[model samples]
Target: MKIYITSLLALLFSLVLNAQNLEKYEEMPEVDGVYITQNMFELLSKIDVESDDPEEQNFVELIKNLKGIKVLTTTNVEVGSQMKTDVNSYVSSENLSELMRVKKEGKFLKFYSKPGSTDQKVSQLFMFMIDEDTSEKRFVVLSIIGDIDLSEIGQMAGELKGVPGAEELKNIKDEK
Candidate 1:
């Protein structure tokens, strides 16, 4: 009986891990507006720059450690709604902690992260956001994975404010 119980527990644990696997996203068919594993960021980071701004240099240093990124976006009403539901369900089932949530002007942003070697570091950062502008509604799911420095997230956030939902990155920066 004890052996059976142990086996059942192990099976359940494995199932949970599989359910949280982000690799599945990579296999998903790219929707009209959704993108996956784009190299744009890496290419942009490599530009030869002669600027003396410490902030600019700092931004470059932050991206140096980012190994992989995935992003999906949709403007379709049905798809956007479904994506939000799917992401929320996945995040909860995976037990990723909610680092921050911001709502403004009918837009919603949420940030989540999975811990790394130490409490101060994160191996993955995930974001889900819904934006309602005058023209249309946009839903986005973004995941960043690598050896992330918790302290530098704020600087990275500053550089990424132009991107949707990236502004929320500042809230969890420096948190252990």
Candidate 2:
């Protein structure tokens, strides 16, 4: 019985990591500012250049690599200053929290929503990244925070690949 239980647990853990294959990623050519891998779509939805905060500054460096960024929201963040307000509003309104961070190491910034909330069991820390060499940005790393629908992020990512820019975002984003 012990052997069976241990094996089952191990199998389950393996299934989790094997969820998304990051290497199989391809940038969407038709969409100017959107790119998708087997799991998530990294996009420069908008650009803000006014803020001096380390996080925002790092975010700018990371996203500069994205080909073309389109703003789905009605936000008018023409410069970095407006982007500062926009990012701050997103963090607060969305209940998004910065958990694990990887800014200088690469172009990926990760944040997660607390688990056990009214939201679905999809507590994934999403990373926003940019390739320094190529200046291409990708939403590439996801770490599990707690128990939830682990596959939710992957499904969302896959959806982004199929749809266009903001239209795809509206369909995949869990606004709640």
Candidate 3:
């Protein structure tokens, strides 16, 4: 009986571990020419909102309620000197621990974050990108944090796919 109980406990532990992993497997959202498909969103989907970390849970709630998402594209290979200047200021001022960050590569900027007390836990990580190329430069992808309505995101995602700037924003997809 003790051995059986131990096995059951081990199984439960594993299940919890897996559940804590990213869950919502939705395609990144792209709005107009804004590129916001950051890999962080994928991981954010896995987090359970009821964790001991209030901050983490708060983020989870936010992601679940994200109304829309955006994506952008650019032709430049590097973050332009002027653009870099602007981004440096923004990234520096924004305070969010980045689980994954890629910037200054082929005119793209991806960001994800959950606003929470660092001492507690990170809740939501919004992922998006910026295209610093052509005449128009902007950070297009943005996922609203906290209790994201999947239906809203879906509806918004579908609409944005057809917009003009939508074509410029690159959509980086994940492989199963």
Candidate 4:
């Protein structure tokens, strides 16, 4: 009985580890939107660093330690709703802790993070959103992985303002 229980536990652990692979999300079917990998982030960072603007300079610094970013979005009602369900399940299965949530104007947003080495940082940040209205449905999922400072999240969101669904992030007021 002991050996059987131990074997089962090992299998469960391995399954959980495998389920966390980034490819799983990238390969998700039928949803159409942006999907950015670390290589693309490096290229984008380098390009932004060439700009003379101070804000762009700050973005260069913030993205220096980033490992990867994945964004998925869809506007089709059926596809969008399904993708929302899929993303929520994936996030929950990975055991990421909820960090923030906002609901307004027929839209809902939730943020999650996996802890980093220090209490003030996170290794991964995930955002999920659903926008529902009479005529259209939209959903988005953003996954950012790296040594992310909790205080710098707003800056990161600012950098990503052009991304679909990120415009709402601009409304996040600093509580301090």
State which candidate has the highest lDDT.
1
- lDDT string, candidate 3, 1-176, tens digits: 99999999997886564433211112223212433333555567676556687555545554544433432323343433333343344444455444345555344545444454342223343444555544665443343443333323333344457543323222321100
Would you list the clashing residue pairs of candidate 4? none
- C-alpha lDDT score of every prediction, in listed order: 0.72, 0.37, 0.42, 0.69
Candidate 1 clashes between residue pairs 3 or more apart in a chain or in different chains: none
TM-score of 3: 0.30
Candidate 2 lDDT, tens digit per residue, 8-107?
A: 9987775553332221222323222332331221334244467777655544443332232222111121322333343445445546665444445344
Model 4 lDDT, full chain set? 0.69
Task: Show model 4 residue runs off by greater than 4 Å.
Answer: 1-29, 44-57, 168-176
Q: Please give the ranking of all candidate structures by TM-score, highest first, separated by commas.
A: 4, 1, 3, 2
Of 3 and 4, which scores higher on lDDT?
Answer: 4
Error of 3 at 116 (Å): 5.2
Number of clashes in model 4?
A: 0
Instruction: For candidate 1, write residues 43-91 as lDDT tens digits.
Output: 7678866999887776676576676776777677776776776787778
lDDT of 1: 0.72
lDDT of 1 at 81: 73
Clashes per model (N, Cα, C within 3 A): 0, 10, 39, 0
